[model samples]
Target: MSNIFTEAEIAYLESQPLGRLATVGPGGRPHVAPVGVFYDPQADAVVVAGHAGSGFGGSRKFRDAQAHPEVAYVVDDLASLDPWQPRGIEIRGTAETFSDGGEELGARITGVMPFDAAWLRIRACRVLAWGIDGDSFELSARDVA
Candidate 1:
């Protein structure tokens, strides 16, 4: 797929450290969590790092991604509280969990302590964005590639 993000979009993604990740559980229940993420320009993917083998096996998000590869992730913020201008990008894609190659995927985005973890790689298939322009509020959607 050609790069799904424009220059501005890429900058925005790199600027943001946290994103809401949506995944479906084995029973088809939706789960959302705020996760530390980074945009991997080389892979053209969003990477989320989580504790390795935390509770039963791994994290809920990791298990959920394994059960259901389809997921949605969003990063948004209010530019102006007075005017209530909100801007962000929503990414829909397939996720793959990696434990063997997660060491280099460490996230320092939030200044969180580093630890051994598994990484979730979200390969963008579709992207939707809104309110990127300073003065105009518009929504745009496009398929990757």
Candidate 2:
């Protein structure tokens, strides 16, 4: 669902620079990789910029997402190891790839990947967040649709 991210969730996502993206690979296997992730409030979608290398278009995550569409993304951190506190959000959604003309969005990552044509746009279907909205031990979950 677009424009469904809560204020807390949006803040959490925007504050983080990296996230793990999980997608389906060959033979229905799951694959996950570290991505340059961002929260696009205007589009209401989480964007993964292929800023790791030059071959982002042929990347496994991109191909897998293209074939499967369904994906999960996570951005989290230990707020305090001493206090045993963890904070994070997990997003479940369908991904769509923009083959070209993503220079504006891709520009979010400067000097990396050189404004390439490959990127994944994930529109959330479900949201699960913790340690940022309610009791740290309680999960805040909802279906975006």
Deviating ranges (above 4 Å) for candidate 2 = 108-114
Clashes of 2: 0
Model 2, range 39-129, lDDT digits (tens) per residue?
7666788887665356677889989989999999999987789888899999999999977755667655343344457777898899999
Highest lDDT scorer: 2
Indicate the TM-score of model 1. 0.85
User: What is the alpha-carbon lDDT for the whole of candidate 2?
Assistant: 0.81
| lDDT of model number 1 | 0.77
Model 1, stretches more than 4 Å misplaced? 51-57, 107-115, 133-136
Per-residue lDDT of 99 in model 2: 78
Distance from true location, Cα of 70 in model 2, Å: 0.4
Residue by residue across 79-128, what tens digits does model 1's lDDT show?
78997789999999999887655544454433344435567789999998
Each model's Cα RMSD: 3.1, 2.6
Clashing pairs for predicted structure model 1, backbone only = none
